[model samples]
Target: MATDSIGNVELTDSTPTDATAFLIEPPRKRTKTTSGRRSRTNFEMLAWLFMRLSGIVLVFLVLGHLIIQLVLDGGVSKISFAFVAGRWASPFWQAWDLLMLWLAMLHGANGMRTVINDYAERPGTRFWLKVLLVAATVFTVLLGTLVIFTFDPNIS
Candidate 1:
């Protein structure tokens, strides 16, 4: 028992269970206010759609490519620098390779971006991870395009 400066009576430690109940309890959940503007747009919807579309196209492109490369004729042993040169001389193979490269790269980059967004919790961490991902994707795309377009057979 205690008394304030005004001499009002007060109780101390009278309800020990109440005090202990709070000590062992979990915190209350936070409620976000939805009365404001809309939340940020979910880019995941586009990414999910892209994955499905790209996967279907890639299946066709990759299967056709493999059949032509492996099942048509002499297969791996028949492939050489001359074979590559002959193939690249045609616009058909060049276009096929270009499409495969672009689609696969875009699909893989978008997948990795989703992964980064899911795992990287911190703002700085997510930003830097996406930055690195973009850098790698750009470098690979550019280098692959250059190689596909400028492959020289006459080089010694």
Candidate 2:
């Protein structure tokens, strides 16, 4: 058994034959992290489902937003603060923007988390990356929601 520089874990070349290489087999059943015990929660499955559902919803939301904001406006020059204020004055439009804001932020954050998990080999690096991701996601969501709901139109 060879150990890494950390001198804690005993690395071995042997791995379970059941865990065939990627693409050759479906994903192996997930177990408890590092403990070899079975995990009770299906967090990963829920996240995967969220990604798929949100992606579909986002496609429609983004397309509709684009059509209304850009193409129907006859280009970017037509968009103005007055136009946005008028749109947001309606509760329905406010809700629509809020939903889009939340879904897009969460969808992007989850994808980034997956990327960090896959690429960040070091535990410390992965942890910090996710912490930053969560912080940024929360900050953006809060800021965006605040801007949408508390928009003050009187500012000259």
Best by lDDT: 2
Query: Which digits, one per residue and each the tens of the lDDT, describe model 1 over residues 63-92?
Result: 998888887887877888998889998989
* Residue lDDT tens for model 2, 95-114: 98999999999999999999
Clashing pairs in 2: none
Off by over 4 Å in 2: 1-35
What would the TM-scores of all predictions be? 0.72, 0.76
Query: CA shift at 96, candidate 2, in angstroms?
Result: 0.9
Cα RMSD to native, each candidate?
Answer: 5.2, 12.0
Candidate 1 segments whose C-alpha is farther than 4 A from its true place: 1-44
Question: What lDDT does candidate 2 reach at residue 156?
Answer: 81
